[model samples]
Target: MKEWFERERAVHIQFYRRQPVVFVKGEGCYLYDVEGKKYLDMVAGIAAATLGHCHPKFIARVSEQLKKLVHVSNLYYTTPQIELAEKLREITGMDRFFFCNSGAEAVEASLKIARKATGRKKFVAFSGSFHGRTMGALSVTWKEKFRRPFEPLVQPVEFAEFNSVEDLEKKVDEETAAVILEPVQGEAGVYPATKEFINELFRLRDEYNFLVIFDEVQTGFGRTGRWFAKEHYGVKPDIMAMAKAMGSGFPIGGVGVSEEVAEKLEAGEHASTFGGNPLACVASLATIEIIEEEKLVENSEKTGKYLRKRLEELDGIKEVRGMGLMIGAKVENAPGMVSRSLEKGLLVNATSENALRFVPPLIAGREEIDFAVDILSSLK
Candidate 1:
């Protein structure tokens, strides 16, 4: 494992602060390092691996699709793509779908669609929000570290205080094309938008004619125990960008648009080569089916409440925020906690300097939750 790490450092880009533990295999809610040390997975690949690693159903479905078809041009039609769209419409209430490869690409498509649909230039976003790393997504994302190196991005993007109606009202107007936000801000420590905030945004949208785009990349696909975060607010967005758990870590994402926005799009305005391919679509379809068949969403809700309750009782925690399995606990030293937790055979990450984030797989049960809480409790 040490030799493999050395070889990787020699060739691979050092963008991410790579962890020392080199995991070689994962199953259910656990991962095994190259040295055969087993660790309980709590991050779930940054909330992307929905079904956990090597889910039997997900693997079988993808393998079946691979045997039949794999890649083709977007110019041609595919059954899996259309079928996935139908399933999403039933869940999300969106009329149209555009496939992509990641959350960043989905946000890019949403930005383009909003700009073209509304014929406006400026956009409105909130503080502590994280859309993605792409240029357009980054423009709306509020973070000095991520934006400092890449200044002069998409122009005229205004940042409002998260869940502040007054600031949102002041920023949104006739010139605004769209307002992009995460219903639950995951990257900046799981800060969820208030009901009043979402209501006011919709009211302003009607008056100003600007679209609303929900960046549900982390909060979607039952991560928040609701299928999508918008359900908690009971408000529908004009455009919704999603990825992460969509394909259970199969590198697939998509943008869901209202019929009005769909009609505004012209041919050749946007496309992707590997987006919505047969294999990716089948993977997503199988994921959705398994989640429903297994009742994982309900499990997430039940287990998440138990986890939050346990965290609230911990002396080290200051506050607990977020819904379902996507949770963040305020700690005095998040980095220290993560490091200590890792040494004790647990996998968690620090979303911010003092906020520890947890987005375990939907399949995680009470036993795993109990074990995880014991590790965290012991650390405290």
Candidate 2:
């Protein structure tokens, strides 16, 4: 360890440690520590690098934009931001959009839109949902461990059972402003909502006239084998929040809203200082273009199926669930197994205390999956 790390051991910032190595560079599907030792990258910056790290296209676009305007306040329009927003509209069928600096900011904007559109204070969120850590986003997040220390969060946020239609029916009412959920819950060990549950969300929204917001931050940009996981169930939400893979590594987040809900917010109702800077927008555009040109979504679906099937047959795996490149394998003693995998040079996360999670890049193929399994099989 370096002297800086040793001295900062008692720092106030919370850190998530998975292995002893610190990454300094990344390529298609690998990371190199500062010492130049290489390891296969399976996390993809917690699912942020949909196109892998330091992609040639990304570098090219960002490099070209660095020579031009980088940022302009929301007061003025910029070409890159407008162009990117148009592409998003074409892809998602959302009429309007708002950009923000991070996933938390996008979630906060969604909440504000929901409240303003419905004129109701109470909002419904599902258990095991990880929206973001900001004050407003944290309000609706149901993880007790994350919310415990910050008591008295923004008021009137309600938690409903995940994937339980009956529970949602009982909790949602006329006073509810919106119902927020992750179509495929990522942080909750890759639990996917059933087709029935997805339909129920739309039904309840129609019955109660509340906005439905899908937090696609983890599953969007081809992570879940689709452009958006909501498409899997043929249901469309009033608003959608996405971020993790939107810029492929750059800090950017966005919210898409229906015309009905979007019209309520007049001029000066919302904005961000550094949300849609030229650099971030250009990077996002390049990522989307690469995904389309290379047909990475199809690869995610095919490769992910093979990987999931192989993982299900692995020793000590209790259950494997999820779609596309985003997968979770339940195992006994997940935390210990995760540490053991790290020691063996295969990286994975214990998303739940008893579940091993994998969110490899969309380009990960059978050879990589086989290597991952080989390493897991070696774990005692």
Candidate 3:
């Protein structure tokens, strides 16, 4: 294994600083390394696997689709693409959609729609919100580490304090094309926006007429145990950027826009070559069906409550905060705790140096949650 890593390092461009073990295969909630050791997958590819790894239905659909047809240009439409779009529209109630290959592309499309519809140059983005990595998306993303190197690049984006109505009001002006935010901030430690904050955005939208955009890449697709996190708050956004789990690990993403906003973009205004390809669209359709048919959203809610209840009872936990499956716990030495949990064959992400973010598979069961808690208890 070391020899294989050395060989790959010698030839390949170094991207991620990966762990020592090479994952060989996965089943449901568990992954096996090359050495045959199994680990419980809490991260779920950053919450992309809506139904868990190698879900029978998911695999069967993708496998069958692959045998039929894979790709054709966007100039021609495919059955899967049309069906997927209709399904998404039915679920989100968004008037129209623009398909894309990934989250960043979806975000880029949202930015274009916002700018074109409002005829405004500047955009108001919240601090600690992660849109994506592309230039347009990165401009709105407000993280120095991700933005510093690409300075003087994408333009006309301003940052505001998340959940601070005063800061939002101060930052947003007539020149602001859109106000983009995550209904629940994911990468910044799973902090949800306050009811007051959401109401403030709606107020701003009504007063300013600036488009409202929800970066629902993480908070969508039942990750928060809700179809979209915004539904919990009862606020509707003009545009919603969706991806991550949209295709259940297949590279697919889309932007949902209101009827008013959707009409602004003409045919030639935007396009993607592989946007609504057959394979990805089929994957997405399969993913959504599995989520609904299996009632995974309800499972997420039940398991989330059970897990949160157990976690909140832990002695060393400072606080447990989140909705449904998107949970974060503040504790002393969170990074160390994560490391210890990894040693015990469980995986989770550290949101802060001291906050543990748990986005386990929506289908994760009672046994899995109990096992996770067992590992967490040992950390204390």
Candidate 4:
């Protein structure tokens, strides 16, 4: 394992500050390092593994598809891709969708569709929001550090204070083509938008004729106890970008657009070569089926509340925020807590300087939640 790490460090780009442990295998909500030490996975691949690691059903589905057909390109139609698209439409109530390979690509597609559909130039986003890292997604994402080096990004984007209706009103105008936001901000410490704030966006949309694009990359696929996070507010978006858990651990993403917006996007307007491959499509289908059949969404809501309640009882926790399995607890020393938790055989994320983010798989139950709490309780 040390040799492998050294070789990777020598050749690969240093994009991530990886942990010292080298994970060799995972099952359910647990991962095993190369030394055969087990660790509870609270991060869930940063909330991408909705069905947990190495799920038998997921593996079987992917294996079956690989034996038959894997990649036929978008030039021809395939059953798995169409079936997945239909499933997304059934779940999200959106008329159309475009497949991609990651959350960033989904956001990029939503941005382009918004411009083409509305014929406008400017876009409105909120503070403490993380859409993605690509140029278009980065333009709308908050955080000066990520944007500073990648200057001259996609232009005509404005940022407003998150959850501030007054700030949002002031920033959005007639020239704004779209207003993109996360129903629950993931990387920004799991801040869920207030109902008033989301409602205000719709109010402004009606008046200004701008589109509302919900960036649900982290909050969709039962992460928030709903099919999508926007459902919590009882409002639908003109466009929605989703990925994270859509393919379990497999990489896949998509943008859902309303009929009005879909009509404007013609062929050749956008495409992805490996976006809707058969393997990814089957993986997503299997993941969604498992989430539904196992009643994992309801479990996420119930177990999440229990976990949050437990965290709130901790002495050093300042606040607990978010819904379902996507939770963030503000503590005095988030980085220290994360490091200690890892040392104690638990995997979690220190999102911001003061917040510890928990995004366990939807399959997590009270036992898993209790184990995670035990680790945190020891810190106090």
C-alpha lDDT (0 to 100) for residue 24 of candidate 4? 86
- lDDT by residue (1-380, candidate 2, tens digit) is 47546655677465555356667788888877777777777888889888887889889989999999898788788999999999999888888888887888999999999988888989899898888888889998888889889887887988889988889889999999998888999888999999998888888889989999999999999998899898899987999998989999889999999999977888877789999888889988999999999899899999999999999888788899999999999888988987887667677888877888899888789988898889888888
TM-score of 1: 0.99
Ranking by lDDT: 1, 4, 3, 2
Q: State each model's CA lDDT, in order.
A: 0.93, 0.87, 0.88, 0.93
Distance from true position, residue 66, model 3, in Å?
0.5
Which digits, one per residue and each the tens of the lDDT, describe model 4 over residues 300-323? Answer: 899889999999988888999999
Candidate 3's displacement at residue 353, Å, is 0.9
Candidate 2 ranges with C-alpha deviation above 4 Å: 2-4, 7-12, 15-18
Q: Model 4 segments beyond 4 Å from truth?
A: none
Q: For model 3, which pairs clash?
A: none
| TM-scores of all candidate predictions against the true structure | 0.99, 0.97, 0.97, 0.99
| Two-way lDDT contest, 3 vs 4, winner | 4
RMSD of each: 0.9, 1.4, 1.3, 0.9
